[model samples]
Target chain A: MPDLNQAGLTITPGTWLYRLPWIGLGIGLAGMAGSAVLAQGHLQEFLHAWLVAFLFFLSIALGGLFFVLVLFATKAGWGVSIRRLAENAMATLPIFALLFLPIAWGAGQLFSWWEGPGEDALLALKEPYLNAGFFLARAAAYFIVWSAIALWFASRSARQDDSGQHSITRRLQAASGPCLILYAFTVTFASIDWIMALDPHWYSTMFGVYFFSGCLVGIFAFLVLVMGILQEAGYVGQVIHKGHYHNLGMLLYAFMVFWAYIAFSQYFLIWYANIPEETIWYLHRMHGTWSNLSLILAVGHFGVPFFFLMSRVIKEKPRLLMAGAAWMLLMHLADIYWLVMPNVYAHGPHFGILDVAALAAVGGVFMGAFGWALRRRALIPVKDPRLPESLQLDHA
Target chain B: MAFLSPQLPSTEEYGVLGEFDSPRSLYRACSQVRDAGYSRWDAHTPFPIHGLERAMGLRDSRLAWLVLALGLGGAASAMVLQWWISVHAYPLVISGKPFYSWQAFEPETFEIGILGGALGAVFGMMAFNKLPMWYHPLFASKRFQRVTDDGFFISIEAWDPKFDVEGCQKFLREIGATHVEVVLR
Candidate 1:
């Protein structure tokens, strides 16, 4: 049984975690100031780098949203203890609307279709949907929908901690299915608009699923790391055990394979068709050091982790599983970078200071929001009806 | 007797069987049995009880290793076959591409790997469990039929090194078995 007492549930004051929000916000401000100084002659580069950082963090949060929604939709009993952490991650979505300002402001430079489709015939044909007004409007719609769902579910779950109401669980479960549908459409178009539109003439129908798979990989990695960190900090006590970590590791492995499948499928179809428009995208990526990064993603992201996480013993070991998770999180960042950076550095891969600054900027703010959400409630949903079930979860 | 035929049962003592009213009692008894250093014993329940394997002191199965070996072997063989046929045997230039196009070979490789892993899992499990046996001495007991219904039972085969007909029966009873019986082979 779990230590259900208040001592294990809440963050103790003056711990590093209690001050995470302030520290994160401070780093975010400094990062933003550094980015401003770095952007003088390289506004286009800064914007592209910022977009990569934004999408990388945003995918993790979106993965968090999907995780929370699925848990409620299935009324999964074993995941209830960890659901609160995902809720905290999802609750950070509203801040991404603010983080999106750079991309929105630099629309003219980052996206080719932003400036009235210019003289390109194919782009002009896509102008109806790719026009600036509609694009911004769609981004707004996505944020509004995402923010609303994130806030509603997160706030209600937090409220359940106070009210101890089972009705809230029922209501969320009933609403989860529709919310997921909204999530699917919004996430799909959002990826198409932001990442795929970077190479406006090139498109793959599998692009959205590819992005979604990466999001799952990101969230599972993030959860494993966060769960490890929180436990090491003396919170959650014995509430979360090896069983939960094993499950998280399994998910991390499963989604890594899923991401590889979708990514390879997209490449396979384009390579097979041999159409110039479709193959051009792969041609650019396959030519330079970008190809090296692509190869690294295939091996690092899927091949190595495949064999590492296959054993039940490794998954049951927290430190080993966390190591795999951290490596996966890095690969996930590289994946987003691969998708966005090839357009900017057509010659090869470029690692620059602005890239790190942009990540620090966006990531610091994301952590700030996540930490703020974390500090606001119990680390786990203390009053959840299935909390006992999650606490008692053990693998046979 | 025919060569390699199934062994015939003898009219000698085969095992001692114990019946418990519930999973909890059976679980506790299993731990005692395990701690008492008795091997060649197994617990039976109508449905799976979590952690019972731990109580029975079972080690992890070796089936995963079998699946992994067969799966990799299958995929590698598939790739080699495709390369041989496309590059060496016929050398047909389909779609104007290279002779050894690994991209085209991937789908078949993956499918065959899954087939191999699946076959390994099924057959490996059967091999480990020793399935398709026509009969067991325990089946002669009328109460043992309840094993598929509401019964929780623990059976200690007479062949166990420490087994003694009267001693094992008393041990089961002391460990909370409601009913204990000795079965004939």
Candidate 2:
């Protein structure tokens, strides 16, 4: 018989776990400041790079928030043990709201539509929607809605550990339904307002879904990497086992495929329609080094990992799964880079010092915030109604 | 007539078969037998029992690797065949596009990859389980027929290095098996 009286897996991370985030935050601040000083003459380049980095981190946090919402909305039991990590990840959404200020400030440099209603009929027509004041308002709304949902759910989850009440579970489940709808609408518009507006003249209806797929892949990969580290650190290993990692790997693999599928569908539809305005997006991307990057996205982002994660052994083995997860995180960064950078360099790929600094700056702050959130509570939802089910999960 | 002739096979024992009341008991028996270093043994149950495979010392199936390889091969073949037919064989440029279009080849490749994976999973499972045999010596025992019903059984073959008639029976009973019997060939 399985041991019933085994020690509970609640844990508080050591000082190092807390310290790493501060170190990352320090690096980020120093790096951004250094990059800002370095790019004194060309401030536009810095803005573009910062927007890319900010959106990359935001996508991950948003994805984390989405996972929490969907897990509760679906009444899932499999993720109960791991849900606190997701809640912590979700709590980082407010930081992204703060981080959006730079993007808000840099609107003129990053978006073509932000250049005012000067001559171009299309720009004039899109002005009402793409104006700076309205853009900032929409962004604020998105953040408010997101932060409220994330904090509300996370607090209830934390409270459950102390109280162990079934009503909390019922409340979360009831709230999640409308929260998911809100997420879909907000994410859809946020993608439209933020990313798609960069190439103002071009549009694809599926862009929101495309971005959504990447968000899931990014967050799932981040979860796996973080969970692996926590396990290796000898905390929560008893509660979160190979089965959890396997399930996570399966999710990562699934979203990887979904991203590919959505990406391909968008490409195919655009290519098939062949309208000059629509095709211009693909045309810009399919030329020069961008085309090569596109191919790499196909093979590296989808094909290699698809086969690698197919085996039960790889997902069951933490090191192997960690490697896959890390690679995916890099691929996700590359994916964001590919989406955002092409507007500036329209001709070819450009890997500059600013890009690295921007990533480090944004990633460090994001990590620090996420770490702060994670340290605020128990690592596992100890009193969750489904905690036993999650703890007993096996891949059989 | 002699009970057995030199040319004729002897009506000797195959091995001992034991019946357990529950999957847990059968699982315990499997573990005990596996720990005792009996290699040629198997547990049969009406439904799959979690951890029984581990208790029986079974390793993961290679079917996933086989399916992945087959799936990759299928996708590659699909892409190559489409490329050859479109670019090399026919060279028909339908829409003023490039003759070798990888984007256009994606759907076919994906479909064929899924096809290959499904085929591999089905056939590999069948091959691993050694299915569709017309008969087995175990079918000769009337009680063993209940393995398809509610019965849980462990059959240790005579070919096992540790096999002995009386000792095996005692071992099975000690491991919580309710009934024990011998089979003949």
Candidate 3:
């Protein structure tokens, strides 16, 4: 029998975990800022765009943590070994909740739809969903829902180790259906608030799916990167079998396809309709400095990832698979940069120091918070009733 | 008289020469013997037998894993190559678009990943199964020639410790075998 009481996995901060990645951030920020300044474009707007990027990447870390909880709650056997690494990131939600204060502070500078001193015609028009008060309230509500679901499921699984009953598994499964639905709704509105509102006049019915696919892709990438770190350190020795890697690889493969589908659906839908409000969104992105960024995203996000992830062999190899996963994470960062930067840098695409520093600053803080959450308990839900099923999963 | 002394292994002692059988009963008997755990025997159908892998208790193929790895490698290579070309190498300013527009790269990235995965699967399947095996050892038997036509057969090799030329002939005859053949390797 597996041991009931076990110490959780520990990822000490010495792996550059605590120290802020200032070097990369500085370089990135400098590149972005220098480009904007030299071009004599809108400096203030460019910096604010970088700030939004920091928030966007933070969402990746937060969303990953949520995925970790969902897998645990469902006793999802396929992702067991990788689930712990995901949990490492999920534990950072409360930190992100606090970090969102900056967006609240710079409301007018970032979102043109937010209420300003004047009548704010656009803000008034979107009063139902785009107002500052409703925005922060929804933000809080999203956290509340996500945190409750994650905490309840995580605690139940951990408690099962001592209880050794099937109830914990049953309970989590019962909650997963509703939790998944809630996750979908919450993410949809969250995307609407964070990125979509950047261009309030523009709308796509498929925008939610576009954001969701990237989130899941980011989730897969983040999980792989974290697991790679753990494996490199020798944590999951035998429990993470070849079959498990094969499955994780396949899921990543599946998501690569999914992300592509949603992305295309959004583009195809908007382009096919060709309305002024919608067409102009593509117009800004497809011309001038933005056009090249759009094309790069086209090939980088879909073309390369789609083809490479399609193979079965690449998904199975740990080193090869992780390399792809890391590449995807970088792609996601670039993807968000493309989505966010065009708003600020009307002159061109900026890839400078502030963009880099802001991301590092947020990442360091989020990691610090996530580490604290992991320290509270064991990495895996030792008491989960489905633990055995996951421990020796047989496949055809 | 031979009962008192140990007998020698020979095709003549096995009784009659090999004979071909129709595919239906041959497959049925092969399956029954397989179910009985006769590891030394092999089925010889005119064409590839469907569900034979499972019937033989073969383990799942590693081909899927190979395909997955190849797909991942392809995606990685595509991204880096795209990045290198756009950012470091060529860095072309096409149509006023950024040299590193990720949106445009998605379709190509997808293609590369898929191509790698496909190549991996085909190659992996061949490598894992040790394919390109132009021949099987059983082809040496004269009776085995019918396996290419409208015939199905079973040959329990002489190497099996339980195989006895006389005893096996009697066993086959009692089991309603149309013809029992002793094959020379």
First chain TM-score in every candidate?
0.99, 0.96, 0.85
lDDT string, candidate 2, A1-396, tens digits? 233332334334455776767877897898778777866876777877888898888889889899999889889998998988988888988888878887888788888777687788988888899788899899999999999999999999999978989999999999999999999999999999988999999888999999999999999999999898987876787788889999999999999999999999999988866799999888888888899988888898998998898778899999999999999988888888888888888877888888778888888899888877777687888788888888888874
Ranking by DockQ: 1, 2, 3
- Give per-residue CA lDDT, model 1, range A1-396, as digits (tens): 345778767877899898999989988998899999999999999999999999999999999999999999999999999999999999999999999999999989898778786789999899999999999999999999999999999999999989889999999999999999999999999999999999999999999999999999999999999999988898886789988998888999999999988988898888788999999998888877888998999999989999999998999988999999999999999999999988889988897999989999999999999999999899998889889999988886
| Residue-pair clashes per candidate | 0, 0, 78
Docking class of 2: acceptable
What lDDT does candidate 1 reach at residue A148?
A: 99
**Across all candidates, what is each one's fraction of true contacts kept?**
0.73, 0.27, 0.00
Candidate 1 chain B, run of 10 with poorest lDDT: B1-10
Model 1 CAPRI rating: medium
Pairs of colliding residues, candidate 2: none
lDDT leaderboard ranking: 1, 2, 3
Per-residue alpha-carbon lDDT of candidate 3 for residues B51-100, written as tens digits (9 for 90 to 100): 55545555567777777788888988898889889989888887566777
* Model 1: fraction of the reference interface contacts it also forms: 0.73
DockQ comparisons of all candidates to the true complex: 0.71, 0.31, 0.06
Better DockQ candidate (2, 3): 2
Question: Model 1 misses residue A146 by how many Å?
Answer: 0.9
